[model samples]
Target: MKILVVGGYGVGKTTLVGAISEIEPLTTEADVTEASTDQDRTAGTEAKATTTVALDFGRITLLRHGLQLLLFGAPGQPRFWFMWDDLATGALGAVVMADTRRLADCFPIVEYCERLRLPFVVAVNEFDGSFPYLAEEVRDALALTERVPIRTCDAREPASVQAVLITLAEHALALHRAQRPLTH
Candidate 1:
């Protein structure tokens, strides 16, 4: 199954993909150049030196579920948003990474998934020194419906990333089953 990891700039989409991927993840990251200083907002992520220019690719096999997930991390900046449609073409679902400090940054990604009718789960990336907001607070802030699953995660941790992925997979599966036509 193909799953997309998407969010705003510096939201840790690349890190999440790399953390859980069994193989060496392929990243199209480039150093943050001076020219983009005006285009890229670095308020909460001033230390972030690189940005994903295109996408990040990774893969993980879930032995228990007999599934192989092809992970695609979408570029977060608005300039590269044109690539999102292509990345989402065959994706079964998505994990929308969120930074509580810049919660608004993820709004577009969540809207995109909803507009595409793509099942998704919100994974709040818990950065150091960031406020500890409960999952319910995030849901309320995002104006998300109860059906949308939300969880706090550290993108750098494999177990946490795995849990987020599992939530997305289960949510997608449930939606698929619900939409299937009943048969004799």
Candidate 2:
């Protein structure tokens, strides 16, 4: 199985992938330099020193179910969006991570998935000191349709990340079933 962990800049895409990956996650993070300060948006992630320039790759093997998930984290910066289509190729679905502080940042990714007809679940990455918002409220705020699942989690926790992935998998399966033609 292939999945893309996508979100806006500094929304914890790499952290989420690393938290649950069974192997050493492959990350292409580059130091944020002053040269591109004007190009990169660093509003919500002021403390972030590095950015994923290409992608983050990781794998999780579910031995019992005989499933191995290849997780890919897309680069969040707008300038790197050229890499998104290539990364999204052959992906089964996506987890759209969002931070309430900068909710608008998630619009592009949501639209990207929708335009591609890709199934996705929205995961609100709960950051400390951030205001508490219900899943329903977030759904409404994002103007998401009823079919898209919305859930909250601390992306840094392995268990929490696993739950998000589980939700995503279930949602994807449901979508697949719904789209499948009924046979005799």
Candidate 3:
């Protein structure tokens, strides 16, 4: 199944894909140049020297479930959002990576998923020196419904990324089942 990893610029969508992908992840990262200084906001991510200009592609197999997931990391800058519609085609669901330091940056991603009726889970990428907000706190901050799963994770850790992916897969499955009409 195809899944999206989307969030605001510098929120670690690429990092999460690279961490969990069994194969060598494909990334379209470009150096942060002065030309984009005014376009890309770097308030909490000043240390970031590169940004995903297109998308990051990765794949992982859930052996237990016999499912293979195709991950597509969307470019975060608003200027690149034009590619989002194409990337979202045939997507089963998405993981909306969140950064507590720039929590509001993720609002658009969340709204996009909601508008598409896409099942998604918010994975809070725990950055060093950033305040640790509980899952509930994040949901409240994002004004998300209780049904949406919100979990914390370290994008750099493969295990952490895997856990978030599992959460999204399960949530999507549950929603799919609920929507299917029953035949007696």
Candidate 4:
């Protein structure tokens, strides 16, 4: 299975990928070239040091199902929107991360997943000890329908990151089952 992990700058998309990756991960990160600073201004994720010049890729195996999963992390910068199409191609699903403080940065990703008809889950990456935001409130804020699964997690936690992957996997399975004829 192939998955695309996407979110706003400094939202811990890379960290999430690293936390759950079983094998050596491949990431395309470049020094924060001063010229591109203008494109990296998102309030909640200002701590991001290296900008993903291309994309982040990783692979893992789920022991439970013996499923090999490939993950592609898309660069968050709007200027890199061109890369989104390619990263999304052939992905089984995607996890769109969002920072409560700068939620708008995630809309483009959500829209892209919608356009591609890819099953996706929205994960809220918490910062510090901040209180949890209501999932329904987030749903209303993002104007998302009830069909989209919304989850809250700390991108820094391996378990949390894995949970997001599990959610997407389950969603993908359901979608696949729904597409086929009943095999009674």
Give RMSD to native, each candidate: 1.0, 0.9, 1.0, 1.6
Q: Which stretches of candidate 2 lie over 4 Å from their true place?
A: none
Q: On residues 19-68, what C-alpha lDDT tens digit does candidate 1 reach at each position?
A: 99999999999999887767977677878899999999999997998889
**Residue 33, model 3, lDDT:** 88
Give the clashing pairs for model 2.
Answer: none
What would the TM-scores of all predictions be? 0.97, 0.97, 0.97, 0.92
TM-score of 2: 0.97
How do the residues 1-115 of candidate 4 rate in per-residue lDDT, one tens digit apiece? Answer: 8899998777878888888888767888887766777656755545656778688888889788898999898888888878988888889999999888878887878888898
1-184 in candidate 3: lDDT tens per residue? 9999999999999999999999999999999988887777778777889999999999999799888999999999999999999999999999999999999898898999999999999999989899999999999999999999998999999999989988998999999999999989
- CA deviation > 4 Å runs, candidate 3: 64-66
TM-score of 3: 0.97
lDDT of each: 0.93, 0.92, 0.93, 0.85
lDDT of 2 by residue, 1-184 (tens): 9999999999999999999999999999999888656787787677889999999999999999989999999998889999989988998899999999989999889999999998899999999988989989989888999999998999999999999899999998999999899999
Scored against the true structure, residue 121 in model 4 reaches a CA lDDT of: 95
Best by lDDT: 1
Clashes of 4: 0
Residue 46 alpha-carbon offset, candidate 2, angstroms: 1.2
Clashes of each: 0, 0, 0, 0
Clashing pairs in 3: none
